[model samples]
Target: MTDRYVQATMDVLGAARDVFSGHDTWRPLEEAIDAQLPDDYKALIDAYGPVQVNGHLYLEHPANPFYPLRTWISETIEDFRDVDWGEEDSPQFGGKAGLIPIASTDRGEYAFLAPGNDGGQSRIFSCGRDEPDLYEHRMTFAEWLYRYLAGEEMFSPGHRDFYPGPVRLESLPTAAGDRSSKWYGQERST
Candidate 1:
């Protein structure tokens, strides 16, 4: 099922028609990661594939030729694995269900997911590239996206503000073969 937040955002902003940029199967990824990701996150990727939201925020796909989800997660985890976040609630990187990056902005701000206790939903955390701390948001992925679309200051400072008016989604290549294909070459500008 499509996530309500993604569906509503698409309903207002429009989506790529007749294109499936998401994964064909998720079991392998779940198994590899040793955790079951949030349904809303899976739905978001399935609904939009790899895309640049409003030309800055990037939502990467597992099969993305430029930057696959696993590589992105690994790089992020490695980069911050040793940083002492100072807060007792700070989630460490690398584990069965640790801090996983969901989205990133061109400005180097990342939206991370901290696993919830007892099989509950993961909460969203925002971290700026230059900052030493993670900002917590006690909400689901869907809720964070909803608030982000509503332009409620969800991301770290210096990232672009949510685009004014309607959301603009630019499709990205999901596979190596699509890189040179004209169908996936163009970017939609606001």
Candidate 2:
């Protein structure tokens, strides 16, 4: 099942190889989160590395120094705590516990995963800066990705400004001489 999701995503994005560092590189991030990340996310990173989908969605990678997943998750959680979004009932915006951000958009929208509910399954929460309400989807990361790529209205109906044409995946440049990083300059294909 996990392989199918990874294959489907790669097929849709035209990804050619497993450009990212494997499970060893992801250890620190998983430890920080205190929970194992979804298998679908691991497969996505393993296959595509750090990528921007259609120049709109940015998925954090283990080797991204500027916006590593650990930093992004911690910072976003802190930011949610600092700002008063006026929704006390909301866990993500109101500083309620058990939610972590997974992906962020160029448009200031974010996708979060909330665990410890519904028998340990994670639920996805999509929210934008301008909107007070959040869009919730009770699916795994792979299911969500499949629906998102299929243009399902339920994922993000109002914000449909994504590049509707063929999807493009651009590999971000890594630091020079960083051989330990998966995005090392020499390893990148032109």
Candidate 3:
């Protein structure tokens, strides 16, 4: 079953990549499948039966919603505590987080996301019968990489979640020869 699903996933993704790129606002379920499904994704298929992402059924979107196989979230950004957390319905929090289903022509629909506890960082869980309420669990940076996408530093600053500043160099190498030194002319000419 897993092998068949993975094979079907690949076929759908190939076509989704083409159509999804153009429709930025309304995307095909194939996009996520193409992006995340692994070559041997069958090995990772969920053993606990089917699951949902956000409130949508695993494959409920207009396009087919592929079972995530497994979903993960990581904390790549910093300063989330700095953001002014607010109502979930607010523009900042509402649309910012949810189950984002990716399209797949063959296997079906797929999703990727970082759902917030109160429009903020907390645990990530797959949507199911009880949805986030039942499936939710703590997700930390050490465990997942996808959490990085949740915070948009440049676009939404008030949202506390910010990317780390560019790394800086701390030290320099010694001059090989006095003649080659940047200070060479300063002392000699003086």
Q: State the TM-score for model 2.
A: 0.77
* TM-score of every prediction relative to native: 0.77, 0.77, 0.20
Best by lDDT: 1
lDDT of 1 by residue, 1-190 (tens): 5456756655554544434544455566666665566888877776666777766778777766566777777787887777787888866775665877788888778888776564554578898756776788777787788677766767765443755556767777765556422222222243
Model 1 residue pairs with clashes:
none
**lDDT comparison, 1 vs 3, better candidate:** 1
| Each model's lDDT | 0.68, 0.64, 0.24
lDDT of 2 by residue, 34-122 (tens): 75677787777666656666566777787677457777778877876575668657564322356677787787877877665678565
> Candidate 3 lDDT (Cα, whole model)?
0.24
Question: RMSD of model 3, in Å?
Answer: 21.4
Model 3: residue 1 alpha-carbon error in angstroms: 29
* Candidates 1 and 3 compared by TM-score, better number: 1
RMSD of each candidate relative to the true structure: 4.4, 5.8, 21.4
